[model samples]
Target: MSTTTAPPQPALPIRGFAEFLGTALLVIAGVGTAVAAPDTGTLGIAMAFGLALLVLAYTLGPVSGCHVNPAVTLGLLVARRIEPAAAGVYVVAQLLGGLAGAGVVLAFRSGDPSFDLSADGLGANGWGAASTGGYGLSSAIVVELVLTALLVLVVLSATARQSNAAVAGLPIGFTLVVAHLVAIPVDGTSVNPARSFGPAVLTGGTALEQLWVFIVVPLVGGVLGALVYRVLRGSDSDAASQDTPDPTTRAGS
Candidate 1:
């Protein structure tokens, strides 16, 4: 008997689109919830982000590993799980996707006669008075760094080859929920730079001024998380090779 093999896939573009769409959906669902329902509180916002990620992980994970976040991409890059060029492309896609999602939210808000992008803010992250709990700059930096680092660590572990791919989404999503729950009051919880960038670009003023904190801290945290993972699991390449599978393959197959 003879068996047919599947054709090779165009790895980059498909993966890139998956990242783009996944990230856009994440912002739309997560930030959209916050904009539409300001009274949802921390748990509601956390659940919004978590559920969005969980669904995206299962839906797009097969195509792009559903990174949807630059910090996560950077974490994989530092771990050597992805090549530099691919990681760059993923980051670009994620940023553009975030912008697109925020634009959609902006459009929706325009429907309201009282909506003000600058004053209302599109769920942009910040410190001090902008922070939900008025946490200071140092507090914001430390909280984002630690939470983002932990989030990336969860991503690295959940997607490892030794992990059960079938169930990775649950833990990864739950970790995001926990991160938001802990850091929402501090700096609105930006473990993802793209997520922070979208609203800042739209809101301007202080959000734009404080944007650096979200971007730099999350990136640093991502690298730290990858390094910590390397320490715990040994060489990244070896572990990644042992568990990582071809992107063309169906997830959980």
Candidate 2:
């Protein structure tokens, strides 16, 4: 008799590359729209992000779960959906991807002689006078925290075992769109730290100064969202127990 083993899974590096590409693509479409077409208004900007994520979710979801956001990765980590090492790699990949995406936007803008990085604001998130609506730091933090928490909750719920896997991207994308609609005027809507980091780094000055708000708040929100989901849906151990075969039935067999 002859037996064959299953093929090995893709290495972490390969998966991380997928994350990098997915996030880079996301920033390109999202930030690109904001830069190239400012008159598209709030709905268009929201659609840009939503559509980009929806496409990437299907494109790279199988390879890397299509996180593309550090907050999402952190949420999955707290939910025990991913290992610590893998989570760290994913976050690093996302940050690098964000930078690359911002660079792409900068390159594209360079073609326009009128474009100025400092005055134009490369869609970087900010607050107070920097904010589009003049929202203060406290408002920015609260909005980011609540919006990110909701976003993570949607991510967790959409990817749950009981969810409709075939259509998970729709809900996830819609959640992001709704988040943008609510938070864009307030702080350009940075539910993902990596998303904010790229533009802020490139723009510098006020954006960079306020960067900490986006980073710290979204992370806290991600963890809180995961904990809330775990509380309401029961722990992973509970799911495992439910899946385990009853000893009495096994013994009867």
Residue range 1-253, candidate 1, lDDT tens digits:
1133323445799888988898888999889988888799999999999999989888987787788989888888888777799889989999999999998988898899998776888999999889889889999899888988898888777777634577888888999999989988988888999999898898899999999999999999999998898888886545464456633221110
In the predicted model 2, the residue pairs found to clash are none
- Worst lDDT run of 10 residues, candidate 2, spans 244-253
Local distance difference test, per candidate? 0.82, 0.80
- Give each model's clash number: 1, 0
Q: Name the top TM-score candidate.
A: 1
Error of 1 at 115 (Å): 1.3
Question: Candidate 2's residue-wise lDDT over 120-144, tens digit each?
Answer: 9798999888988989989998999
Worst 10 residues of 1 by lDDT: 244-253
Tell me the spans in candidate 2 whose CA falls farther than 4 Å from its real position. 1-8, 236-253
